[model samples]
Target chain A: MAHSSETLNPFENLRLELRRGCLVLAVLAELRSEQYGYTLRKALAEHGMAIDEGTLYPLLRRLENQGLLVSEWREEDKRNKRFYRLSPDGKLILKQLLAEWQSMNASLNGIF
Target chain B: MELLDRYLQAVKFWLPKAQKQDIIAELSEDICSQIEEKETELGRKLNEAEVEAILKQLGRPLLVANRYLPQQYLIGPVLFPIYRFVLKIVGLCYLVPWVLVWIGLMTFGLSDRAQHPSGSLIGALASLWGPLWLAAFFAFGVVTIVFAILERSQAKSRFLEDWDPRKLPPVRDPNQISRASSIFELAANTVFCMWWVGIRSPIIVLGQSAARITLAPAWRYFFWGFLFLAFANIATSGVNLLRPHWTRARASVRLVTDVIGVALFCWLCKAGILVEISIPTVAPAKTLEIANAINLWMSRSFPIVFIVGVVIAALDVHRIVRVKTADTRPLRGVAAAGGLPQQ
Candidate 1:
């Protein structure tokens, strides 16, 4: 299937929000192993979902504020990097959100 | 150093004063770390161009900083519901009259004209143009008065539904008004002088014909009175801005300005300055051509000027309310907690 840029236009903004929504789950799921900002962005992109630094940076801060994620700054190679990991609270929330997503998808598909 | 400086400038534009320095420091550290990672991945030193490109791609610094700030609404958090309500009611009032006028005009041709006897049934139905116009004028007057009263009462109440006063800047010392009043006086004088030209033009042109009982010189006085009132307002606003303590006096000045503006405008029509232009051309017809022309001009211009003045006054009131509310919020919050200490 050939996908054109025009076809992608309507989805562009929606895609960003949907990706942000899923990033909560993705970050929690990924940070089961610790990762820094650039590494996480690259990892997500490699999995066919590209996230910008602008979006990733704020989401990380907000998740940390909500106590669903924890971060620590470490000096490596003479550069300080903040590494984020999934808190126990983040893991629980991610699991619940995933379950909710699946149920909603099932119900919507059934109705359609 | 250059890259760090650019990043700091971006953050400074968005963040508040207290948090800006700390946020900049953290952002710089994060960017440096990202650059190192990028350099390692590419197996080369990242050039200035590449680093700048990455930062630019990060989007505006304000956009990034705004994510941390709470959401803002047009009417602000406190007045949002009330604002929506007032907007809906005002919208309905305007829409109903407008729709009725449109329907009446449109159906006039379809209806019987001989029975109506005014060429159009709508004109006959709306024969009492006097009462309809008066009702409209009264409605506008009541709305303006209500808005002004509500604005002041909201400031005084310091209710939870009202805006947070803390967010507004502190009122400057009242001394600022004395210095500012001179400028306002100049502006008011200029406007008045222009209007005086408009007023005196017909008298100069029409001479004795302009002085007839129907040609009221009293109409010209309203314009003069408006100019004087505008000058008084300039003085009061200047004094209020400069001295900071003359709240009541400043408000009264504003109220007087509004009243004079409305009165001068209405009387200008009633006195027939608007009719002056058409009277010379249409006098042979002598069939109310002058009055019709005057009505046409007023209907076209009055609503526009009235709306513009109301909007400007509303904005001024909003600014004043914001300032006053900010000053009294903490006290009100404390008072609310203490269970009604004072009137």
Candidate 2:
């Protein structure tokens, strides 16, 4: 079976490189309210950014590791689930990133 | 459910040791939610095949596990361009010279060791290939290891930051002649011209033997012509040392001199018995035999010399084209720096 990162076509590889940065902003934006792994994937997919289960789990771990996100295991529906939310640092960084994104988008529109 | 248990176990086996139980617990929760969602739609629990399909969608156990760990490679993208440059440096500066020396040894040195059968030169060359490839492989391995360590350490950025563009060597021009080489050629040609002028009899005594070798009377036709070509060569070399560039005038002079030199070689080549033994009075046949043997070596060497002269003349023709192109090329830096008068 092909692995998650294996043999993406040329267009797919480029699309992935373009999407990698946006996914971080998207995750931080959605984690404003607390959500667990499955629900977060469902929410992102509902909002037109379907992430792979493999890709989402590790990205959450990395963000938590970097102090941009915080996670805690809590009991729900008789089984334990890891819940995640953006940290205060994440909120500050996200605001800066959104401003940067808007300025860049306006510059690109001017060029176009 | 059993298949799901086995799938989670496979993934857990490859996860980082400290985080295995925690990651597996979260992954198990996600998979359970997925299966529960599917069962609600189907109005029953998922079969074994359905469980396998869901696990396949998550991806390979190792790949899913690997994403949580830090990225690893022998050389990462940042240092890869420099890695390629180092490899080319190894090829040009290291491997090429070693291969050339091996070729030189086979041609000049080892040929002497191989007794006179020219075919043995090829055999001697074949024997060295194994060792040459082994040395190249060893060099490649060492460069890769050094680059790998640099990629992983903090020193990569420091090495890049410390580089000075000003210290790079100046760009080389192909048409420019080396002053040192021109000087050496001029000196050697001057000595040759002097030796040619001092020889009155044109006689070559073979050591203390009475078997003296004398130039045939036919050589008298080419002596003055040969001396004139030598003087012309010396003049060209002298001019090159001062200017150090392949100007059209210098190339023309060298071409004309080479044409005349080649004419002399072709003219002398026709003078069939160019050398003869002056004293073989006792046996006329033996005298002819010894002279034939000496002339045989001469016959083999002159064609190689003739071909080399032709090739040099061809190169001078190319140099003339280069000189014309160099004339047309704009002096950009000189113009920008206000070194040239305003147009």
Candidate 3:
């Protein structure tokens, strides 16, 4: 029997909630190295964290808006692509966030 | 390439006007790259179906566009808890009570006409569902409108931020004030008060007979007192429903009402001949005999009723003192920390 797309799974809902913040963090960290939307998604997927272009593109725009990332249009391989990379503000935020994440991870590990 | 262009256009249609061209350009580039990657994997160019599959994987155009749009909620998550809390209170205080009263009045009316066979209770309930549902929907609409207004004005954040945990209500004791039981008691007391005040004669006719036994002059003599007592009981229950905390003022009010009730019953007992049985077909002797039996039973029962009221009054007095003392120093700390204090 085919399951309806709208049929709810609590686990999936929870996974979405858990992923929401983690996705932001991952995007911020990955933008430290310059990449366009497609290449960034491929890079994340290669490292076992696949992000959809829809999510990645919006996130990049949002981060750029927040001054956490910068973007520019450049011709690459005869096709125009919008490239995104971490801004100075983004680099500072990333350092603080990594420390916070490390502390949280260490505390979690101790508890486990 | 044409399929990808159409897909990007669909997404662009939903994007914000300022960012339309920029978003579409980026999306078009990404799709072209994905198609290139797919062709490399398959060792051939793709068909329309393959491109459509990629678009499907990207998700619905509106949903994909929503990620780029600013997050919007009619009632934002921050205020949702308060909205839910208010809705719950409305349900418990308003909707639940409304539903209970509907069912209760139906049952009360049926009980009076027990001699006649009414249709199934389920059928009666089914018939009542339409009006009940309409009322519920109206309540939901009002709540939604109120929350939507709050959201629009951005007043929800102010409400959340300004809230003080110190002013939170104390935990209610299950024994002292059961909301369901209080509501039921309030309903019964309301019905009784209405019967006493509104009706000329409060009597249930026995069997299918036209004859009825009505309350005697004694009831008339203490009619105002009976009403005052009943109303006081109703009022006390109401205040408790609105504010369930057990405090000195509340306890004092209940104690005074209960004492008046006891006194009223005592007066009725002393002023014998409470209910006069009226049966035109019956003999004078039989009528006197029935009336005497009823009067005697009522007079005998009044003291017991008085005693029960006294016990309740005593309990109320005890509660009042305890709560009053708790309001003072040392234990005042407890009150500060969400203890049962006067509203």
Give interface RMSD for all predictions.
Answer: 2.3, 0.6, 0.7
C-alpha root-mean-square deviation, each candidate: 21.6, 7.9, 12.2
Candidate 3 lDDT, tens digit per residue, B58-174?
A: 888888888899987889787688899988988876776666555543454354224334455656655667887888888888998998998877753475566778899767542
Q: Which structure is stronger by DockQ: 1 or 3? A: 3
Q: Give the clashing pairs for model 2.
A: none
lDDT of 2: 0.81
Q: What's the ranking of the predictions by lDDT, best on top? A: 2, 3, 1
Among all candidates shown, the one with the greatest DockQ? 2
The docking category that best describes candidate 3 is medium
Which 10 consecutive residues of model 1 chain A have the lowest summed lDDT? A1-10
Q: Encode model 2's per-residue lDDT on A1-112: one tens digit a residue.
A: 4555568787888898888999998999999999999999999999989998899999999999989999999999999999999999999989998899899889999999
Best by TM-score: 2
Considering only chain B, report the TM-score of each candidate against the true chain B: 0.35, 0.51, 0.50
Q: Candidate 1 docking: what grade?
A: acceptable
Q: In candidate 1, what are the lDDT values of residues B1-343, reduced to their tens digit?
A: 5875877697778777776764565567667767877898999988889988878876677887876565643334455456557656765667445544544433432333345557565676566466556666676566656655665666668665656779887644321235455566657666766766565533445465543223345655765576576567656656655554535346556655775676567456444454434244345455366556765565445444444455556655655675466456565554556643322
Off by over 4 Å in 3: A1-25, A103-112, B88-134, B153-157, B177-343
